[model samples]
Target: MKSPALLGRITAVFRQSGAMDKGKGKVTGVIALTLGGLAVLAVLAFHFPQYLTTPDLRKKYDVAILREIMLVGMVIAGGMALANLIRLRNRWLNGTALALILLAAALGGHRVPVDDFPDNTPYVGLDWFILDLLGSSMIFILIEKLFPLHRDQPVFRPGWQTDFTHFIVNHLLVGLALLIVNFAIHRLFGWMVWPPLQKWVGGLPFFAELFLVILVADLVQYWTHRAYHEIPFLWRFHAVHHSAEYMDWMAGSRLHLFELLTTRVSILGVLYVLGFNQTTTDIYIVIVGFQAVFNHANVRVPIIFAKAPLKWLIVTPDFHHWHHSSEREAIDRNYAAHFAFIDYIFGTAVKSERRFPGKYGVLGDYMPPGFVRQQLFPFTWKG
Candidate 1:
């Protein structure tokens, strides 16, 4: 049972002057959830932040600026939540947000911890979750709204809840991902670590090393991505990513846990073996994160992009959208993750005349929706 006031508000919000409609509810809901969740996390991180923030992540920086940013974001998101509630007229809609604000305030919002922090604990990555969620939404959502390739498409299209759940799980479990990958790499490649090799890698200029990292990572990703498409068993899991009918920044986040783990460990192992500097690896991580969201975003490139070299330099929305299109020509094309050159070299690049995908999803439309079903799909699916 829902309130009429909420229903009427949702109707008005959905009926607003732009691409918003019933479909846009997901977008608004996602934004509202993101703002509220991050705000709450900011608070929790302040109270029990010693456990929430990982040593590897916090080694180089402090959370002072981030805490202040969270406080401000909490206030702003609270307002946005209110606006959405008014638009959607939903009480439950704002109730969670209200709870977050209250809890954050009660837990000493914006108050920094002055006590000695413990290093050995189960790291939850609440801080990283807040940072990445807010950062991606602020950057990509803005771009998608301002320059949508699918003009009629809402920010939150169908199946967004599924993708949002995927986003949350992946970000919150960063510690586990890091733990698994690092453990595997160390045990598998430890014997190969040599001082000469390390010195050579460490000696390279920052920019040169960065270039090499991107190239090596993209090369590994190309083959890995191709394998998921070409290999029958792997396709069982990979199909979950392709199952999304809507392509947005969040679309890229809808990956199976197995697919996520294998791909990350594989590429990261290559980087580790090559002895890329710690700083270079860190920067590469940030670059990869940004590119992943940007390439999958529903934003359009200016007409000038078609004539410019930007498309050749890296994967753009147009280039990646073809990869997600349900059209026959796009089924396995544009497999490169960061750079576009590998796709060109291998002839896997999109050669379609379409500027954007008319449709998206697996070719057979076989994969199921919802996070749990998608996660269990590979184990239970029938060919």
Candidate 2:
């Protein structure tokens, strides 16, 4: 037998050689595939502008739909390529990466020309989805990477099906519901004897009016959100939102449609009563949109600063994560929408030294996925 030192040296050499070979192989494969894919996309973009820019071709096909199709396809292809690369440890998956690059190019290539819309008209729906939701998704992803709430949790995991469904219904489907609710509220409020109310509210300065609108809306939302927790009748619809096991940007979109409509109508009632200007109302919506999603995100802010002055003005991730927690103490606290001060003033604030919740999701994991079941949940006795 070899001496102890010699045997140790041999083992070390074997381990080092294997690790080095694995590292080098992975690096080489990633680089070769990425570069080869980008080169092909560059060539196609330069030579085949017609396939992308031709109006006749685009008219026959809805570019937005096609873009979504290609995006999904590319994502699947990239996933498969990455999986195969890991499984085989082979450079041949470079071709699969090239296919992904081409798919990505196709998705981005078919934007309708700026001149296609009338000079004054703005693109809506999918254009807004691409610009706003996609941009927000990227920002949230970056925030999670840079300032993760739970460092142990994987940032991008395999549990996105529920989150994706939530996003689709909450962001896209809710628009129609909001429109109907807004119209109905306005008509109903118009018949009321609040003529003087509008005149007074409308006379306020723009910034002041905007602040009031937000405050009023948040007040309504504060109560509505609280009711969703306190009232078992409403908890069913609300539980669907709390069903998310992980918190991220899209997590806020998991609310049930009935819950969404009820909450929105309450806020809209406040808006109509306050007679907010369209511009101010629009700005308020934008601010609330960012706040609603951001507060629920899995981001870590510096504790010292976040708990100090900032805590009074705006709801941070720490404040909102507690709301999502199933902890008994955190159950009814932090009910404020945009401001934590509301919770404090109302005696509902629950303070914690820990930044992130140990556990999330509803107290009992009873809710099922899908819109219809969630809508009917509030009335059912299964809670």
Candidate 3:
């Protein structure tokens, strides 16, 4: 069978009642496939660290812990597959999962030693991709389950494959993306870097520096984001992100490559020119990373005290969701990423009566479905 047909058939199992039903084995089979698949990729990264693993990420994480995680993933996937085989359920999915796990084992599994490799070797961010995916899925999925905006939203919702493909591509290309951003900053904005100003900015108190960096970065993003809505040419690339009809954690990953490069280059370029302290910049990265995923997440946080004050201070899922809505009032509104007050100050915040948006995605829904198609859409689309 074709790949799409096979994927459709497998995903259909997830739509059934009570996905955790042990007898059906559908959920377990999917889990096995996911874990098994990541294990295989992890093994490949181990074997070809020079070409696959990221240098920056390698220094930060413990090899022993990652190896342990790989081992546990293999064991869980294999055990689930075996159980499914015994129950005679989801044979295709479970069998394929088992095959992948065996393949990973044959390729030295987690035992593949990482000999000293040249750090300058051109590479993808495979290690970053694996770690971030594991971390985000574990944290965000649990959050969504606990405080779900749409209670019935499944783990494997429609358009997930497309969003996941986007996620994988974006993560794997992190090395290249960083390279581009660094190169652009140095070449284009080097003249803007005044040592005196940088020193002054760096000498600020830790909290002050943190607040300044976030505000500056968000200001750059705010204008860039607004342009993506107001400018027709830029909208072509931005539309790919807005095409995600569903509002979930993974929905935020459905971004076009052009948009990704331009946006990062723009925001990071400004930050570089400002020259915030490295420590503050690092913390800002962690904060921005967490909030980026959290805002787009299906989870909702209920603020009992100072609810109105907080909504005006920072962006929340409820606030950002309005920005993604296709409704007439929401179009080109709520463009701020970090601070809700930016929108309120600029007269762009949505003033709707209802709490959340009824629909998501582009107004006309002209964007295509697949990753490649969506990426090419900016150039090819007539309107």
Q: TM-score for every candidate vs. truth?
A: 0.87, 0.69, 0.93
Decoy 2 TM-score against native: 0.69
Candidate lDDT (C-alpha), each: 0.79, 0.65, 0.88
lDDT of 2 by residue, 1-383 (tens): 34575445433321331112344344344444444343344234323433322222224446456545445544544554566566665434444454545655564433323233322222112323333454686588688878988765544333445565666555444335656686878876656637688888888998889888888888889999999989987776778888877887878877777877888777887787767777788788889988888888878888764666778777888888888888877887788878788888898887777766788888877777555666566777453
What candidate 3 gets wrong by more than 4 Å, as runs, is 1-22, 303-306
At residue 5, candidate 3 shows an lDDT of 79
lDDT of 1 by residue, 1-383 (tens): 45686556644543343344344334445356557666767767777757787677777666677777877777876776677666664446455565566667677777746467788888888777777777787888789889988777766577777898898899888888888988988888777778788789889988999999999999999999999999999999999999988888999999999999899888988888889988899899998988888878888888666544767667878888889888988888999888887888898888866677788899889988789999999999978
> Candidate 1 regions off by >4 Å?
1-34, 78-92, 112-114, 308-310
Deviation of model 2 at 152, angstroms? 2.7
Rank the models by TM-score, top first: 3, 1, 2
Candidate 3 at 85: error in angstroms? 1.7
Which has the better TM-score: candidate 2, or candidate 3? 3
Considering every candidate listed, which one attains the maximal TM-score? 3
Off by over 4 Å in 2: 1-108, 111-124, 369-376, 379-381
Clashes of each: 5, 0, 0
Worst 10 residues of 2 by lDDT: 118-127
